[model samples]
Target: MLERFIAITADFSIIIPFIYLLFKGKIPLTISDKLIYVYIVLTLIRNIASFVTMMLGVYNIYLYNWYNLLSFGIIAALYFQILNNLYFKMLVIAALILLIAIAFIDYRTLLNVRTTEFNRFSFNASGCFTILFILFFLYELIRKLQVKKLTEYPLFWFSSGALLYYSGTIFPYIFIQYTFNNLANRDLYWIIDAVLSIVLSVFLCFSIRHMKHQKTV
Candidate 1:
């Protein structure tokens, strides 16, 4: 119950920046901003739905797999907009292949969306893919060698949030089964997850705030 409470708190915290966006409708967001907006909203709805379904004793975790797939696609597009490197393009292709394979596997393994199981393959592959893209995104930034402070750059904050999240989550989520069997005392791991989530939320808010400031300046 405590774990669920923490998860819900972190999940709902995402809407804070989204609410800011809604209130500042006059502010135009870049394509990347729009993508992040959609991602956050989808995540918020999925979280709320997951909680409701959990309370009703229904199968709903599968919904998150769909969210994961869609989030990858949108983030891929965002990266495509940010840089035009061949490797990044190939990374997008590989990610697409993995997404399709994961979806196919789920469809074949489960007759319907009613199971306690999670798609480990897709989930892990996504973690790895995100890490790669973030590394590339960071390298791209380094190559440019921008003179501006990192904090003032919106993309820097956005990419940093993603980097911290995927990299932080890779081990815990991928080895969750092993963790449960070997390490029963896993509260510390969850605390890390919660911290990463809050950081992502804060960075996202900063990214938008910086974007708004950039536009006005």
Candidate 2:
């Protein structure tokens, strides 16, 4: 019961940023800003769907599979926009394409035997790529010394939040199948994931709330 409550709360916590951005009354002009907006909305939709499916006791692994692909695409696009290097941009595009293909193949190959199981391959790949992107962005930020105050930088918060969540969850997600087979392990995984998710949402809220102060790269 506690686990369920925490998971539900974390899922709905996304509304914090969603509402903040919606009534803030400022249009997202930059590609990164727009991508952030889209990513939040997409996450909200996925969470809602996940909640409903959970209530209905329906198979919902596919929702996560789709969410992982779309979220990675949006995030990769944001990094592509912010990163100045042509090679990094090309790498992002390639990673996005590879992720899509991997997701497609994983879904098709496992649809029969693992309809209810998490898409571990795609999830781990996306998580690793996201971490890599965050690291690359941070490296570029430090190398260029563009922003004097890292806290004031919006993408800094975004990247940090993403890094925290993805890095924290990658190992558990990689072993999700094993975790799911054991009830106690599964509950622990969800609780940890939920906690990290709440932290990520808070960081996203900060990121969007400070959009007005966003510095160009």
Candidate 3:
């Protein structure tokens, strides 16, 4: 019963931000804001596809692998847009290239072994890179002190959401194979992931809603 509730919540939570965006009837003007909207739309599509594949008992791990790459690329672009430091932007560019290459190689290697298995290395690598990006953003945010009210800042909410979700899930993803082989409750890790996803979605909703009020960062 709890698992079903979590699954349903996690699946539908993303819609909240979409609905809020529609309700506002205002398009985001900045590149960073636009990227966030794109990320949300893609995430919703991925969730639907994942759910459909699961219902059909299909191997959906590949979907997540693809999504990991796409998600990292989008978020990296977002940080690149918002960050002012030339050095940080260059670092983002370099990290994006290297990480995507490594992730693609990892994906191809895993495809040869078993398509059904999780792309653990790619997922974890993306999480690590994303965490670093968030830290860079936060450091810049502190140094600049542009926004007096940080809560009203869209990137703050977005970065907070990403940080919580990635930091919470990376360890579980690392040990997922062990959990599957040895643990009685394999769903435990996924439940945690779902909860964090829901939290992230809520934060994204806040970020989207605040876009009109706050100047693009």
The top-ranked prediction according to TM-score is 2
Q: Which ranges in model 1 have alpha carbons more than 4 Å from their true place?
A: 108-111, 179-192, 212-217
lDDT per residue, candidate 1, 1-217, as tens digits? Answer: 7776677677777888788767767776777777778877887787788879978999875776677777888778777776778777887887878776876676732445775455556667887887888788888777776525778877778789988998888887787555422335455576667778778888888877776433210
- lDDT (CA) for every model shown? 0.73, 0.84, 0.81
Error of 2 at 216 (Å): 3.1
Ranking by lDDT, best first? 2, 3, 1
lDDT of 3 at 22: 80
TM-score (all chains, Cα) for each model: 0.85, 0.91, 0.90
Backbone collisions counted per model: 0, 0, 0
Better of 1 and 2 by lDDT: 2
RMSD of every candidate to native, in Å, equals 3.5, 2.2, 2.4
Local accuracy of candidate 3 as per-residue lDDT tens digits, 32-105: 77888899998899899889988988867677778888899999999988777799889888988887777766
Per-residue lDDT tens digits of candidate 2, residues 1-217?
Answer: 9888899899999999999888888665566778888988999999999899888888776777778888998999899888889999999989998887777776653455336666657888899999999999999898999888888777888899999999999988788777743556778788888999999999998888668645667
